[model samples]
Target: MKKQSLVKGAFVLTLAAFITKVLVFSNSIVLSRVLGPEGIGLKKMVMPFMGLMMTLTTIGLPVAISRLVAEADAQGNRGKVKKILVISLVITGSLSIFVVSLSIFSGKYLSSFFLTDPRSYNSFMAMIPIIPIGAVSGVLKGYFRGRQTMNPIAFAQVFEQIVRVCLTYILVQRLVPLGIEYAAAGAVLCSVLGEACSLIFFIVMFKISHHRKMKISRPSWSQAFRGKNVLIELLQTGLPTTGNGFVISITRAVQPIVITKSLALAGVSSALITKQYGMLTGFVMPLLFLPGFINQSLGATLVPAISEANAQNNLRLIKRRLNQAIRVALIVGVPSTLLLYLYAHELMTAVYHAPTAAPLLKLIAPFFLLNYLQSPLQSVLVGMGQAKTAMFNNILARCTNVALIYPLASNPLLGINGVILAISVGVILETILHYSSVVKSIGYALDIPNIIKILVAGIAMGYIGRALFINLNNLTSQGGATLILLTGIVFSIFIYMLLLFFLKVINGSDIVRIPFVGKMLGKIFPK
Candidate 1:
């Protein structure tokens, strides 16, 4: 089988992710308006718990499946691929069933204690069915990703988002007259149907694909199930990945509870607490993560790509890919950080209709750039079979966050700002650790000079663009402010590229490194 180029795969996935993010962002905007802050807060509060349940059900099998399948595909072992899929499905499916049962049985206790909002009880219960449906879709996604066939995975994601946005909007609007809790429950219910839609799409795509007709003999239950080897391999790879996920999910699940409880103890009212939580999670964090879709797409493509290269013991290929991934991350992430820092207020007001999100967004913008880079570095570590090291680093970060969050959030002077500080500190620390681990594993030196150059270029572009926006803002009304900001953003990107060329941070050679546009750029920026 011919391998897909990393850039091509990343581009495809990035396009899909961009669309998905837009749709989801739109859904969030509509839902926020329909449900209001309290309703949105109710949903956000249960998200961490739902994420924890998902982590428990998946047990990181998706990563393991992708890595194992990539290795098997590299070796042309079709039967092994089939067996790996079978084993993974059996394991995750059973775990999913267990999780759903547990959630249904423990909903009341979870709502009363962990959530502290009895109104969130129905939303918590609504997440039960999503676990199993999402688990099945996740496995299929990993399978397609491992095969380096990103189209199906891309299609499934976009399709899922479409279904989710439409359903969530419809349900939330219909249920809003009942109560905010019912509306929140409607939003959660959308997740279940969305996953089911994606799963069905994957199954249909898989059935029609050429791989389904491959002439490999199916492994009997005895042959596939008899050996501890497959189970051991799965556990070895999946456990550490799952451990990382489990720790993060635990912290996430605890964060809202900690924040609300701490704020309440600090004399903040319950309603205000929920509204504040909604602003942070629903508004500010989304803006901080806007550039993440690019890195996430790159990271998703990196795993199977790196795994395949590692399996072949191609050290040079691994180093080259790592360098490319880091450079691309910096190129995109640095400008994003600067843009968000400069335009936080404008963006918040424009996208979320929440001017209050500006302060938190500005506070976290620079640190969030490190968070963006962490995604690819962690992916590289997992791809290089250093998942245990990655897991340890993540656990340390989460533990640190948990230890400090209450103290910071409960402090009268700090409050929610303290929570943001804790998060920023955690992200920076984790990124450094992940980067160090990747360096140690690969024995490749990162290009710090180039990174510095990118940062310089980004800062220069941000100031210049800010000046232009300020001049333009005087001429535009509130109705056209978003358009002007968007126009400025476009100009900012162009200015960044121009500065990159002028500063020699990016030249014809760098331009030629891009996927589809490389040839066009080469012609335009001849060395």
Candidate 2:
């Protein structure tokens, strides 16, 4: 029953995250298609700043809420969990108001300066309303995650994405024909409406869940609203995590600023620069990073298990679990990055209808490996109660990213490639810092042999896939590209897995445990 429950939780969360990622990808595609690269570029410009605001407002409180609630669950302390929830709502909600105000009042100046085009002002305005709604929704979702009740968050995500896609389709089609300004407004409004819908869905879900619990044992409002305890717990969990999240948000947000400047100095026109940035950061990077969803789900499931082991001072089990986390991260991340690079053009053309994005996609695909692997590593740190280390490592990386970006991007010689290089540089540095901490805390190198194996396997497979793709493109008509690309992908997976199997890099058992692959492997490679 326990194993089943864990698997169930992981499965649901995976589905939820997968859907959320798809929705987000859809949102980006629609925004880009409707407003073009210029509009999407404007949105990207504001994203980092908005992310900073949202991070500060929430201040890691939602994640802290989850941790606190989980801790309370371990102790069978419902009163403590209730108190944390109430406090989380109050703190997150209040911060949301302040952020919303800042966004609204500062929208005009921000839109003009961040984006080369001033026409994105209306879209900026639409984003202001999203702050408060988004923050509240975040807290609620975290609350559910902590309680090990993922359905509420999952359902809310699906509902939110549906709302977002529907609104974007309706609004963009109606508004973009009016002018770029109206298109921008429509884009922002889609976000605001989507967040609002998610918030409402969460509220309903929370109420239903709470009502069911109420029938069992009434929760006292006064007790649940205890300020002092909630504040202490919230601070204990949220503050450090907030710092960690801040680092990540800031690092991602600044990519555009760096890229745009780099392009401008390279003699690229402002009008064309957005497309360049979109090619790498906006499109390719997301697909590469998709496997992180698996890592995240695994990390989430591992947290409670690790927490239990921690309470018992079970060092061996913790080490075993940590190794498992790293292995799982590699298993997902390595193949995904390679596959992305192999089919970079096909994937980009299929999704964005833009073939020019191919080179940038290849350049940025490596970061997918770095990005996804870090999630599990970070989780291991948090589980071990070293959230401060994780926070500092993230801060250091973001600072390095910022520092590297400006100088590299300002160089007239490098252009948009400078920005891409800067991002990759920062990522490599960050990975080093993170791994150092993992080693210091756990007293072992971060499975370097496994990483090497994965990399080699990926490279060999990528080469084969690319060769096949090139041949196909030469032999077949343009419309046959999709069929050829799919064939190459299948071939890549086959070769990679066969090599890994022979090398014993990953065994049949590991393959048998992954969702669809496991069942298929059973049929193909009978025990």
Candidate 3:
């Protein structure tokens, strides 16, 4: 695919991701009100196990399939693409079943031992079916990604979030009368239904797309057996990637347990500790991740785009893509970090009505811009066949987090703050490592001056916005506070764009690359 097409695909996926995040944010707001901190805490606790299970079952097959299929598609080998998809499905499907069975059988043991609170057992059980359904969906999404057509994957994402939020609200409402535990479990069960819906959408879309391609004769049984090399290639690419994900997943699974236990040891009550955990995970962290949808979409597209370029030894294209990816990351991350830092209190109060999360949001806001950049950098590494490098870096960072969190969280003075510090440090460290790895892989240094200009622009825009907000607050009544904030934010965006233009951070060429409005902007700007 052309570079313009890649950018367009990323744009489409980003828009979808934005909508999805909004739905998810809305879902979290409803859940926060309905479930309270403890119920939300129980629900959050079950997520790590679910993540680990899905990671284990998929075994990085989606990424491997995407990379391999991109290479095949680049070479115009339809048969190879078909073969890769079939083998991936078989491997992932079988592993998913095994994982689900294990999850069902071991739920009691896991919940009893690993979780600090045993009340999460039912939630753990409810999350088991998400594994197989997600596993199937992962491969199908990978197939579409390799094809460089993002609409299906994008639609599935938004559709899944819609279903999840609706189902979770309905289920939690009905189950709340029984108990918060059952309510939390019911909330967790929504993932199973959501994934099932996404899987169906992916299957239908894949069939529709597949039927449009020219027919290729099916390979005979012996020919299929001869394609064992494809399976071997998948394993070779997948194992290291899976190992990286597995390490991260294991650390994540242990994180809540460690933090909660450490806080308990520091003389905090169990109920208070759970509430703190919920506040951090459910409220503050989601706010931190609000800007990540752009990075997520770009990272997803980057894998195939870079893989295809690498396959054809197109060094110039690879470098251009990497540079553009980094620039886009900064453009999004800098403004987001600044806005969150400046408006943490107001945003928390406005969105979740939880004042307690404001300080935590401010504390973590600085490092999260770097966190947003991590996914895209790691995706570049994977695209370059350097998955192990990214994996090792993540493992090192996660190990650091685990090592420091216990001591810090157990400290009487630091307590929960220690956990937050550990997370912030981990995010910063991981991004630095990933960035260094990408630099080494590409043999090109990032444009430091351009990054500095972007940051400066963002800082200036944030300051101006903050000033406007304060002035507006003094003039407006309580009823108009949200409106004032919104106006200030909109003005800040306009100022930021003008700064980008005036500072030469973005030029006519960049503006002209935007999908539909590019031409109009070019005509008006007349570079």
* TM-score of structure candidate 3: 0.83
Off by over 4 Å in 1: 26-50, 101-129, 165-190, 214-224, 256-282, 348-359, 405-418, 473-483, 501-527
Query: How does residue 98 of candidate 1 score in lDDT?
Result: 86
Q: How much does each candidate deviate from the true structure in C-alpha RMSD? A: 4.2, 5.1, 4.3
Question: What value does the lDDT take at residue 171 in candidate 1?
Answer: 80
lDDT computed for candidate 3:
0.84
Evaluate model 2: give its lDDT: 0.72
lDDT of each residue in 314-402, candidate 3, tens digit only: 98888888778888888988988888888888888888888888888888889787886787788888887788788889998989988
lDDT of 3 at 445: 75
Weakest 10 consecutive residues of candidate 1 by summed lDDT: 215-224
Provide TM-scores for the models.
Answer: 0.83, 0.76, 0.83
Q: What tens digits encode model 1's per-residue C-alpha lDDT throughout 1-527? A: 23567777787789899899889889999888999999999999898887788788888888887887888888888877877877777777788878888888889998989899989999998888888887877788788878887888888899999999999878889999999999999998897788889999988888888786853234344654664577777778799988877676678778888888887776788898888889999998877777778888888888888888888989898888877788788889888888888988888888889888799889988888887678778888888778889899999887887778788888888888888888888998898899899878888787778788888889888988888898898777567887889988989999999988887877887667566688787889956
lDDT of every model, 2 decimals: 0.83, 0.72, 0.84
Q: Candidate 3, which segments miss by more than 4 Å at Cα? A: 1-4, 25-49, 100-131, 162-194, 210-225, 257-279, 352-359, 406-417, 477-479, 507-527
lDDT per residue (tens digit) for residues 56-151 in model 2: 788877666666666666677776666776677677767877787777787778778866567767767766777788787877767676666766
